[model samples]
Each structure stands twice: as C-alpha cells, then as structure tokens.
Target: MLKKLYGKLEISINALESWMKERKNLAGLLVGIVILGGLIGCAIWLNQPVEGEVPTSASQMAYEKASVTAVLEDGAVPDYEDAEGRRVGTQELEIRILTGTHKGEIMSLTNYMSALFNVDVEKGDQIIVRIMTDEDGSYYASLFNYNRGIVLGVFVLIFFILLAVLGGKKGLGALLGLLFTLASIWFVLIPCLIRGIPAIAATVGIVAVTAAGALVLLNGFSLKTLCSVLGCVIGVVAAGGIAALVGNITPMNGFNMPEAENLLLYGADKGMKISGLLVCGVLISALGAVMDVALGIASSIWELHEQNPSLPGRALFRSGMHIGRDAMGTMANTLILAFAGSSLNMLILVQTYDIPFIQLINTDYICIEIIQSVAGALGILLTVPIVAFISARLMARGKRVS
Candidate 1:
C-alpha cells in the first residue's frame, strides 16, 4: 500500500488544466468553510435567549481583576462568609450585557461570591468569566463570561478568508488538515482516554495519526512527508518520557493544573492515577512545537530538493540542518516570550515583592508554566537534528527510483 501511494507521488502532473482545476476546487472549499462557519454562528445567535429570558451576565472579563461596586445605600450587610467564619466583604458590581439577543440590561454582580476566586474586585478590572442563566429571566454568574463562542466564530471567519486569499488551493488543503486535526483530537483521542486507554499511548497514537494525515494531505506521501512524520513522532516520545520522569520524582499538589488537580483530589478517593493525567497534559502541550519542528525541517529539505533535484544527501541534510537551526532559535524564543507576555502582570507582582528565588521558582503556577515552555523547547531542539540526520541517511543510501 505504501509503495503504490509513494509511486503516485513521484508521477508528476502532466496537464496544466488539472492544476487550474485544483485551484478552483480550493477556492470553493474556502468559500464553503466561511459559509458554514457563518451559518453556525447565525444558528447559535438565533437560538440564544429571547427577551425577558434569564439575563446572562459576566464580571471583570478579558482581564484578571475582579469586578467591584459599592451600593448607593449605606451599610449593605455582606452576605458571604469565608472559611474562618469571617464575613467576606461584598462589592456591588454594575453590569451591562455587551452582546447577544439581550444587548442592553443592567445587573449587579460581586466578587468573593465563590470559593474559586481570590482577587479583590474594583471599579475597573477585566477578567475572563463564565456566566450561568436558567430558562427563566433570573441569572447569576458562575464565573465571568460564558460565551467565548462568539469571539471564536469571528476569528474562524477571518482565518478562512485570509487562507483563501493567501494560498488559494493549498490553503484549502491546510484548512482540511486543521479541521481533521481538531476532529481527531476531540473524537479519537479524548474518547480513547476516557475509555481507559493509557494516556501516554493515546497521545502518541493521536500525534502519529494527526501528523500523517496533515503531512500527507498537505505534501503528499513522499520523502518530505516521511521525514516530517518520523521527526514529529520522535519529538512526542521524548516529551512524554521527560514529563513522566519529572512527574514521578517531584510530584506537587498538582493543582498547578486546573481540572487535573481537582480530579486528582477526587480520584485519590476513587483510586485513579491522576499523575497519569498530568503527564498527559505535558505531552499534549508539547505536541504543537513537535509538529512545527518536524514540518519545518522536512519542508526545507523538500524545497531544497525542488530547487536542485540532483543535490546529494549530504548537502540536503546540511540544508535541512541549517534551516532548522535558525527555526529553533526563533521558535523557542517565541514560546518563552508568549508565556512572558501572558503573565506580565503576575511577573510584576514577583518583581514588586522582590520575591526570593527559592519562593519564586517554587511557586506552583510559575513551575507549571516553566514546564510547559521548557519541555516543548527541548522537544523542538531535539526534533530538528533528528529529522535532518535521518532524512540524510535514508536519502543517501537510496537511488531515486526511475
């Protein structure tokens, strides 16, 4: 099966019109994606609550600070109590609906209403929120904003349009690759894990499936696709091994992650291995960078081959390695800077307190973020060289089949 598929890849397209047809097909695909996404958005909007339905409200959204307000009436007794039986102060929050069918409604919200929050609310601070509303007009926020879907839809629209304009038919292939990735992760990986499959094995399997589907669908089943798949698989395994070793030696309270920690606290009673779940998180987080490193090196080798098909394996390996070196430097920096940018404010608090190195690095949140950045970086660095080295060995030993 692999031989037959590989043979087709080597057979060049002989007709110019076929290439144009591919372009038209891709253009149609982009249009279809945008239309489908827009339809979904419209469906969601239409199905949203009608007037006098329970008003959906959120607190300091889009930022980390809580929302607070003082009632106009003096001496409003606070209704919330903390763990120590001390009356936790309440701040009156004036809320307005920003979007949806119920666009204009004023409501009052508060901070410290739930045990999940710690930040003090103020007049102006933004935080992500999840809101809950019943079928009735009554509503109370469980968190901040409940509807991220609206924003997600807008971004999807922009992405499909941009892809259509940018690469035409190839863009369509990329889009298909993306949709397939999302589908497999949600449908195949998550279901397999929930059904008692080993998390590590499931992760490896999904990565393998995703990498092959994406690379083949984009580059076709050829040398380029082979190198990328092989590279990505190695990187994923390295990441899984590193995560497992680190987790075994120094297990934290593990609330360093969200649901995993909660599940751990609960799972201990049920005798489930929550540590396995944590390892899964680390593996999943590293998957993106692994694919990036693999594809980057493989694609560079392919482009080099196209430019000079007669180039020897040694030179092709060197080309891939050089390109990978440059890519790794920027990509690793990108991952770190992205983390720093997201946590700039928390970092400010660390700086303000002159936090001792021991306390700062040991902090649970900081530790987890570091794990995310560093593990991914290590995987990426290792992948670039591995892909280049193996591709060279394979190509050098082979005579191009006529």
Candidate 2:
C-alpha cells in the first residue's frame, strides 16, 4: 500500500515537472500568481468601509440596524396604480432597533412596495433603517434593504460548485480569473475613474490586464495563449477606436447612454468625462466577444500546428486564415444576435410606436447598439488574421527549435 501511494505521488510530481519544463510555462505561472496576489490585495483594500454623509445639517439623523418584531395585521394594503400603471401594495410593520442610539426601541414603520424598488419583510427579519429627526424633535424611520448576505453567499457557493463539477481544474482557474477581473473593475478601474483618471486610459489598461489573465488561465503558457493575448489586445483597441470614431462623428453624446445622466450628476464635482466613459463602456462590452474569437482562432491554429508539425509557417498561416474565415461568419452573427437580444425590448417599443425605419435607425439607442455589434464583429474579423499569423509564426519557430 505504501509503495503504491509513493508511486502515484512520484508520477504526479513527474507530470507537474514535465508540464513546467518549458520557460513559457514557468513565466505564465509566475504571471498568474502575480495577478492572483493583486486580486487579493484589491479585495483587502475594497473590504474597508467607505463612509459618506448626505451633506445635511440635521443633527439627529442616523442609519440603524433593526429586526422586525411583528407584521401588524391591522395594516391596510391599499390597491393603487403607480406611474407605470402597475399595481403595488403597502404594508406596515412593527420593528425593534437592534443597533445604534435607538437600540431596543420599538417603532412602527411603513413598507411601500413599488414595481421598481421594494423589499418584503417578515417577522424576525433583519433590515437597515434610516432614521431622520425633524426640527421639532420628532423622528421617522424608513426601511432599507434587508440583510441578504446569506442569499448572496448561497448563490456564490452554488456557482462555484457547478463550475467545479463541470470544469475541474480549468473551471477553478476560470473562477480565479473572473474574480480577478471583477476585483480590478471594482477596485482599480472604478477608483481611478473616481479620482479623475482618464476613462479611456483606465479602461484600456484594465481590459488588457483582464484579457491577459483570462487567456493565460484558459489556454495556459503556450504559443496559443500568447497569440490569443496579442489578438485580444488588438481587437480591443480596434473596438475602442471604432467606438470613439462613431461617437465623435455622430450626434450621440454620453447622455444617450443609460445611467449617463446619473453618472454625470454624481461625478459633476469630480469632472468625470461622461463621453469618454461612454466610449469606454462600448469598448468593454465588445471585449468579451473579441477575446472569445481570439482564443478560438488561436486554439484552432495551435491544434492545426500540432497535428501537422512538419508544416511550414506559410502553410500553417494559410490554414489558420481559412479556419478564421469560417469562424468569422458564426462569430459575427453571434455578436449581432447578442446585441440584438439586449435591445429587443427597445426594438419592440419602437415598433409599437410605429416609428419609421429611417427614424428608428437614427435613434440613439438603436445607433449605439448598431455601433457595438458592428465594432465587435469587426474586431473579431481583425483578430482572426492577427492570431492566425502570430500563432503560425510562433509554432513554426518552436517546431524548428524542437
């Protein structure tokens, strides 16, 4: 039994050593470690509490934690139509403060359920309450979001479990890459933007980092991964350039984007560039598709090279180009369909309004979607040849070395 266990361990170690024998693999491993470390650092930084005031002179205002003691069966659920003609309900509840200056105090609160913003509460439920004191010493408490940490935790656990079961080690790597990307967005990119960093520059930097991490994790430290990274970067740059050109040539400004007005209003004091941010948004949206195309083409070419190791660089490049052309058709349709799906509701609304084709096409939303789809498709097309050439050249060089 001892001999068998030792033999298996030796085999595993040997396999691992063989896998890391290549310098490229060692470098990729080091880069992955650095990215993961950066992600952890960002997580620690973002975990710190961020506090801000509402810029009010009211002295007695406070946010408190509370627990619902009772549902107040006497509460009336008045039937009413909201601005959207949708019916909503309201409920009153009795709650006891769990924390803050009002700890142990009982209060009657109203819960308004709207089609847009609402949360249901039950007995013993924990919630956040915003307590505001009037000039006359009277105080009121408003119900905020309930404590949904457990739900979120459960959702995340399920996701990881599914990923692990389906993907094994590869899935774990993908998860790590995903976490790193998200951390970069939430910690690095957003903070930089908030600090008045140029939106285009910050976005491009983050996109490049994300692409590198994802490609390396997915494809490992090989010529394929290198080719994918190069292709993805070029595709992202192309997409960003196209988006900028379109935004500049067209009358569409940042205001045409959803949440643009809100961002502008909030960041007015910070002087955030809403237009550049809008272009950044388009660039980010198209990046995923571009990366997908790049990796697919790179992997396909790498496999071709592996199968025909004797093939010259020119033959490999030609084969890659042929494969890329075939992939371009489906990938372009995929990008268009994805964009179209997201704008389906808006399209339906436009059709319902009986808008003319010319006018409909001229709409800001429609035009933005069109630009995103076209730019992403163009990026994919561009990435194919770039990846093919790079992968073929690298593979041929490696073959000669071997």
- Output the number of the lDDT-best candidate: 2
lDDT of 1 by residue, 116-204 (tens): 33434444444344455567956554335333465789999899989867967767767777777777677666655544567678778
Worst 10 residues of 2 by lDDT: 74-83
In candidate 1, how many Å is residue 149 off?
A: 3.8
TM-score of 1: 0.62
lDDT by residue for model 2 over 1-402, one digit each (tens)?
A: 999999999999988877756665677678778876876676566445446523434344577888899988534343455535443567789999988878999999888877776676789988888997887988888988887767889999999989977999888877877776777788777766765678899889889888898777765676677788888888888887887788788866577887777777776566567767766776677777778888888888777777778888888889889888888899889889988888888878887999999898887778878887888788888888888888888888765322
The estimated TM-scores of all candidates read 0.62, 0.78
RMSD of each: 11.0, 6.2
Worst 10 residues of 1 by lDDT: 60-69
Give the lDDT of residue 192 in candidate 2.
67
